[model samples]
Target: MSTHRIRFLAALAGLLLLGAGGNAAAQSTITCESRNGQYQSCSANTSGGVTLSRQLSSQGCWQGDTWGYDRNRVWVTRGCRAEFRVGGASSSNNTGAKVAGALVLGAIVAAAVANNKHNDHDDRYDNDYDNGYGGGYGNGREIRCESTSGRYTTCGYVDRHQHVEIRRQLSNQQCVYGRNWGVDGRQLWVDDGCRAVFVVY
Candidate 1:
């Protein structure tokens, strides 16, 4: 072969070797899958950063939403199945944050569950309290009655035995009690008018 061709082949072989070494050095494969639509964490050397090298499922593999890496493991959620090229840990170091983050995530989930149970208990207590006090006089409530286009408008519920009065007038139209505005059974009515806030006691 020609001398020029021999030199060219040698350079090409050197370039190929360097590329192979680079891939073998930092790039390796790890698969993380979200099973049954649940979050799954797979062990990996994640430090420099992780990139989704390939998606292995029909579900979309989105970063920060479906798949993400913290310090030492790759986590996947929402049925995202993908193969990741773990650049391994960065040259800086791994500070064992993976375990810490996992613990924190567990705590957050537990707190949320506890809070939901507490709220449910409070809701039940409120219902029981309401049932226990049937037809009792409640605190004074504010009712806003607005007259739109000179038409009568009714605002909130009014107890038949409760007293209601105009607390604040929101319109230029004068709200004359017993004339332009009054209570009808359980509702406050307004006529010929503007809007006004009422305090129903």
Candidate 2:
């Protein structure tokens, strides 16, 4: 099985345990919290069973929405902060659906990857956001991306996971990587009066 499939199965195992409600007075609990809107995991005996006992954040603690568990730990994301009750009986014989579910998920992931690759070329746009050099990154056309007056501005579309390298610098303001300019989400951003022509592969 692929790594993604294995991870999906392990997380599913924890969701199943939540449904198998056992002891209400389970003597164990642990607090899991998401720090600054980032996902966080906390150690707990989640195999026993898990339930959200109390919420510490204004973000609602909805099961499988803001919080989830695996066999070993409970995770919180999207500013969720909560104490989870653990220590109910671990459910066995629930492996029947795990493999089937993973197969379906693997297919979905593969299809998404294929679709993204097919349309990636057309996704980049040449907007008036920067002086026109052209929007073609791999088509041998260069786009002029610049930050004006030390203000941050988006230049062009570049995938958050895609690598962008400076093909040529147009500014004397030092187009240093990650400081004066960088890719943020699906757009390239420039800051601190940095200007450059970027290429993405």
lDDT of 1 by residue, 1-201 (tens): 344654555555455444434433367888888888566889887765788988998987767556777778888876789999887443322223334444544555555556564554435434433544212335545666799999978877754445666789998989765446765546678888868988755
lDDT of 2 by residue, 1-201 (tens): 456765665566555444443423355878888888666888877656788898999976666545778888788776889988888554354444444555555665675566564655434444411334344445544457988888889977754334567889999888865456755556777888998997764
TM-score of 1: 0.34
Cα distance off (Å), candidate 2, residue 95? 18
Q: State TM-scores per candidate.
A: 0.34, 0.34
Question: Residue 49 lDDT in model 2?
Answer: 78
